[model samples]
Target: MRRKQAGIALITAVITAALVAALAAWIAWRQQLWFFQLENQLDQGQARAIAYSGVQLARFTLRDDARNNQVDHLGEPWNVPIPAIPVEQGKVGGRLLEQQGRFNLNNLISNGVASDNDIAACRRLFELAGVPPQRVDALVDWLDADGETRPGGAEDAAYLALPQPYRAANQPLTDLASLVRVQGFDAETIARLTPFVSVLPPQTPINVNFAPPEVIAAIVPELALAEAQAVVSRRAGRHFASVGEFIAALPERVRGQLRPEALTVQSRYFISEVDAQFGRVTVRYAALLERNGPDFPRLLWMRRR
Candidate 1:
């Protein structure tokens, strides 16, 4: 009887040991999953908040930087500066750009008309940047109010000669990407030119306080690259106090394109970013608050990374 009792006790002990081990393993697994879930939730919430805050910061920075988005914290203006990259899984950061600092799209045909000087300037700018003048000349022909192609430009005749079908953009460019559609305008070259030019209203010239080095060189033909760099460097963390003050920083030719009214201390666009880490996500927004008004920031672009 005593031997039988001993056997029963040993079996019971083995079952209890197995059950305890299984319970411990299950608890560890649950803890690990909970930890990860909590971390993911925190990151998501933070990213959403940071992206929202970025929009506000951009609006504020634009206003503080004379509506020039390139201004860094040091008060130095940038022409086509790269944005800050994201770090720390859940952190968010972004760079702001000002459209007015670039060559105005409307500059293509000023005041609903094209002028010889403007055409020459545009052609010269493309040439200096290594673009074929023939291509730019054709682009201008398409931009003109009439359908006639200018001399040295591509027209329907030229288009027909090409194997690939092509169409002229007879109307104004509604977006900045239209440049690649022009003949001889490749994506590589356009990407390089993006820093210097803009597709904004043609009547507006670049704001001196915000003009990138490329715009400075394009606007003021006489300006050496160093001279343009100097203008950006010497501002001592400040924007040009007036259009005249800004002109003084330019070469004689750049002065002609600028006007007193061209200076603006307001912001028209902004980029807000948010980063989250169930993976990563980034959202960008453009803010339009030309006047003092109350409105929640609106969404512009959303990207997940």
Candidate 2:
């Protein structure tokens, strides 16, 4: 009976030992998971701080450029892309683009009236981009204060007839992406037009110094694509000093078609982008800035991803 009790004790000891070993493993696993989460949180916090630093750097660069340079152009230091700079366990990079370089979609409407000149310019842009001209009227109708639809435009009545009915905005576009909601505009068209257009404050003129060759060609009806491209190429060697100088460079036929008031060498709107990387994680920040004269630049909008 003493021997039997001794065997039972041995079995109990073995079982207890197994349970203890299992508990230790579980505790170790839980601790490891906690450490991983902590590391991730730390990396994310660092990345966010770095991204904001990049934004401040962009703001400073823009302010300095505005102070020293009378004109904003592609050749300026501000236009140069910032290469990734290594930091503690990570890196950051960014670029600044002048938003006024592109055509402003809101230019279609002025106050309460639809400007014929602006509509013509937009139609020309769409034509140059190979987007269907049929959608142009709908865009005009969407922004015009009145409900009266243009010949090819869609009003509230037309939208209501659709399977997924919605109302016409009948107001200025707050965002460029809002184009998708306009009649006859699809994802494909929006994608095609996005690179050449922006939704800036109403009445902003196009900055000829930074506009792409295609946009230049669209803006000047008489200017051929080749001629626009030539102007862009030449600007690299000698940037246009003023709108007058740019007009002088154009062919007489093209020069005659351009309205001096519709062009400018300066830009008020800009986009700043920062990409921050930490370990295996990455964060991005994009901010839109509006610089009015010598005053400090204002952040109009910001987005993070």
* Highest lDDT scorer: 2
TM-score of each candidate structure, all chains considered together: 0.59, 0.85
Q: Which candidate number would show the highest TM-score if scored against the true structure? A: 2
Residue 113 miss distance in model 1 (angstroms): 1.6
Alpha carbon deviation, residue 59, candidate 2 (Å): 1.1
lDDT of 2 by residue, 1-305 (tens): 99999999999999999999999999999999999999899898899889888888887778777788778888888888899999889999999988887989888899979988888888878888889767788888888876475333446778888899877887888777789899888899999998889998888988888888878988898677789999998888988889998988888877788878889998888988999988767899888888877777888887784
Q: Once model 2 is optimally superposed onto the true structure by TM-score, how far is the C-alpha of residue 295 displaced, in angstroms?
A: 1.8
Angstrom error of the Cα, residue 155, model 1: value is: 1.8
List residue ranges in candidate 2 displaced over 4 A: 1-31, 149-154, 157-165
